[model samples]
Target: MPKPSSTKKVKTIPVPKSIRIDLTGHQYGRLTVLGFAGYRESAPMWKCQCDCGTVADYYRCNLRSGTSTQCVQCRHADLGVRSTTHGQWGSPEYRAWEKVRQSDNVCKRWQSYENFRKDVGPKPSKDHQLSRKVTTSAWKPSNVHWVHRDNVVQQKSNSHLIRFRGRTQTLTAWAREVDLSPAALRSRLESGWTVREALTTEALH
Candidate 1:
């Protein structure tokens, strides 16, 4: 009763009417969104539990975009593997395997160096390198080879590199996936069509 007599009704600020996407219970790589962590500036943040059991806050966009897949400790741990030379961890041969591996060109059956070597054979010399026969096609015995670095063909100036679903490919490769003309897709992209719209919408002509 005493408080009610003295206190006056003051205007209160309302929470901003922003589009909030609830990512609770969603897992993005090693980080799983546990709950909200308020806002960083105007952007929302999420409280995530890493695979290593570290709980921390990260930006919503980063988690949603697949940019931040793991905690810092886990990333550092990964470098430990990269620091080795047993598998020639950072060597060109390893990189060649990694490149195709990440792009889903090679399957899990070819994961180990032994299997890769069995299929790919030993490198003839230091100058020899692995090359993909078809940029878009999956990597297999018939689709890959070893060639001298100097003998590699230079890509053309007009060749465009576009990324889709975490894999970067030449515009020509993407064209194979679309039923419409590659020119039409290129035109759509050039005309500011979103990736989804350009890839999905069929042309009348």
Candidate 2:
């Protein structure tokens, strides 16, 4: 019988000091030898083992020479997928967003929304925790009038609450009590009137 040939030891390449392996998705640190085909010194690519048991190319220049230690799949797991759609432009949810985008009065706010979509991504919901009143449902064309933030304070102050006070009073009725026409009160508030001016009964007269 022929004697068994002695097995040659395979050379293990040293991982670079700067190299960082994305191990979030991987359960083990050891690389699967099957996926990474034996070293090809001539080519610029190497087959890398994936946690999913799939083989992928890990550029030698990227792995040993640079910072890449794992396949593209591992990299994607670290960074969430980025969306290409604008916040309101392509969304089917905000159907009336197109009209606001074209209107002159609302164009400024719409432009801001568009810019935000370009930078981050679509967010149909309000994210500012400081202001609890802002909501996606309230950010409509008619509701969102272009006035200074201070004017928003003025409107909030003058706004009538017609709870069950014997009989609910219409805004026109409340204006009558304050001795001012509904149109006049609305104009004062819309024109960025001071909070004190909106609250005082003298403005009504």
Question: Model 2 segments beyond 4 Å from truth?
Answer: 1-111, 115-169, 194-196
Error of 1 at 108 (Å): 2.5
Instruction: Give per-model TM-scores.
Output: 0.42, 0.23
Best by lDDT: 1
lDDT of 1 by residue, 1-205 (tens): 0112222222222333453457777889988777666653334567777777766777665665465677777865774575463556655666666555543236456666546667887677898777666544456777778878776545321445666778776665776786666666655543334455456654443
**Which residue pairs in candidate 2 collide?**
none
Q: Which ten residues in a row have the lowest lDDT in candidate 2?
A: 128-137
Error of 1 at 172 (Å): 4.8
Looking at model 2, residue 183 earns an lDDT score of 65
lDDT of 2 by residue, 63-102 (tens): 4323344445554443222223332433532323433332
After superposition on all C-alphas, the RMSD of every candidate to the true structure, in Å, is 13.1, 24.8
Note the clash tally of each candidate: 0, 0
